[model samples]
Target: MNRKRLEQILDVSLTMFREKGFDDTSVMDICNACGITKPTFYKYVNSKEELLRHYYDGALETLIQAMDEHEPSNDYVALIWIGLSMTASRSIDLGPDLLSKYMILNFHEHTVTARYSAGGKQRTVEAIRKAQEAGQIRNLCDPEKLFMALKNLSLGLTLKWIMTKGSFPFFSHYGRMVEDIILPDYDTVLKQTGVDHRKKTG
Candidate 1:
């Protein structure tokens, strides 16, 4: 098949998978949608499962790319959260069924899981270290504990969105909440500590 046709097939397949899920969507569904025969579909992908995995992994690759592009700052946690929110927003548009499939099929077994678990922990820990160096975030909390808290918050938000049938605009609202939790206004923190902002950098 040509490059454009292959791209078209994958696009339609993702849409169908998002709508009907992996198990429910069949080769016939993809072929019918793409106006091709079963033989043609099979030429591109061996099975619907493979297609599902490909699309899911593609989304994850996008997330990792976004994370890599984020530049560290004094509020590293907040910056990471912003990048994560952008990733979340992109993933959500890929369809909830596809998202749910990702959770069900590869939540514990995929490359993305490794990145989410191992890579994310490292990134959070490193960001905390940076914050400690900058004397911005408090060092009282263990880096691992902070990482878990942030991850749990994001997962909880995502799960709630799924359960509610997408009732909330999660990425937008949740980003603000995460920001407040991770990086509250610097002036507010200073004022709370009895440091007169007006006398210093204020």
Candidate 2:
């Protein structure tokens, strides 16, 4: 397989799916957009659904990488915020409709989506455990429960954003939730943990 060409096809297909919706975007549409013939497109992917699966995998891979790259800090809240921001930005990049379709397809499955979700949850649980050990999380709740709360909040906000057709500002909403509700005493936590809270700016 030509990796570069495959990427090009996926990119074009994602754009088409985002703009045109899944049902409306034909295989020929994707092929024409990629400047490839149907046969060539078939050589890479068997169907439009497969193309969508590839797109979902690509986005999930990005989030997994971001989660892995986050360095441990006493400001573990910031680390969580960074992961949330990355996820929100990726969903926004995919646009609402494509994201909705992706969610619907694998929302209840033990598939690629489930694998990514499990990996992300594991990373989050680890982060929470570290924070608890460092006394950043004063509540001393179960790490798994805390992780589930965070995950639910993130998923709920994303669902709302999609349902509203992108009228909602997910990134800003997530940041505010982190700053005001989730970690209102984040600065104090950092200080208590003897770690300076250095604000990360984009």
Candidate 3:
């Protein structure tokens, strides 16, 4: 019933769930591993799904906080580097399968799940908007559109990196590619837009 005991249970359950998945992990599996009885286990949680929700919820909150705290950088290239580094650090603590599986399982369950996913996308968009406003990104297209484009590139890079087990090293090259994308149209938009988006929040 205490916080420490609950945290221990959650940690144990997360490891087991990650290794064997939700369906394969049972209350008995958790209890036996933790030296607790079924009644004792039930005191903290009702089911495996609830535990998944807890982990998912905590991970998403951490991600949002990281995005919020990223230092404001002038250029899109710099921002991409900063963003990927933040992402790598956060993803390192959890399994690589965490985001993909959570997205697959909960993307359609409720408005809150949809909001969590959207919040990530929105953060990326806002970062780009801030960069554009700062005159650090090209302005040939809409800020939102540019954000989506950059997001797609990042997603592709992430998938490639995951498939190759870090062989591609997207983090090393992402900033340069982002720079290439924004540099061609920098002159027109850079001068026309002066909103200073780094000050905005999502």
Candidate 4:
């Protein structure tokens, strides 16, 4: 399946859902919006709810691509921080409303949640090892264990944003949480990456 075509379907679906509400937005409504038939839609996703999973997974593509293109000798800690910054931006773009739906759906289908992100999660774990070797991350951090912690943190932050309706300075808060809890010395990482995440995140 053409991934661009799949993205198109997801984009149109989001727009329709925002305007029409998810419950009222039928598969045919999305199909009509994307100019794809039901069979074609099914080829892209098993169901509309699955689009939420695809959208969630799509947020990681930027990080994966960055990791793929990154030089091995560069600051691995900075690389991880920049990748996650982009991932956080992508999550915000997905909108809290959609994220809430995704959270609720995944809550009921907990087993399927991690299944959607297996490939991306593996790549992130690989990056974690690189970061650890660079001395950017504390050596005490176990790669897989750290990955689970960051994953849970991402979900928790998403819930926080939804509950607040984005009233807070999200990126700044996210930066503090990461630096203080998830990724130590992450401020230095952001500096090395040349990312003024404050500007980018807002």
Name the candidate that leads on TM-score.
2
Residue-wise C-alpha lDDT for candidate 3, range 98-127, written one tens digit per residue: 544444455456433322256566666666
Tell me the TM-score of model 3: 0.55
Candidate 4 runs further than 4 Å off:
1-5, 35-44, 57-61, 112-116, 137-139, 182-202
- Top candidate by lDDT: 4
lDDT of 4 by residue, 82-145 (tens): 6556666666776777777777887788744432266567776777787666555664478778
Estimate, for each residue in 53-135, the C-alpha lDDT of model 1 and write its tens digit. 55434545555565566542244544456435544555576566666666665665553532254554566567665655555
> Which stretches of model 3 miss by more than 4 angstroms?
1-5, 18-24, 39-46, 59-93, 96-104, 107-123, 152-202
| Model 3 lDDT-worst window of ten | 193-202
Query: TM-scores across all candidates?
Result: 0.65, 0.77, 0.55, 0.71
Clashing pairs in 1: none
For candidate 2, the TM-score is 0.77
lDDT of 2 by residue, 103-134 (tens): 77766453433323666667667766776676
Please list the C-alpha lDDT of all candidates, in the order they appear.
0.62, 0.69, 0.59, 0.70
* Residue 202 local lDDT, model 1: 33
Count of steric clashes across candidates, in order: 0, 0, 0, 0
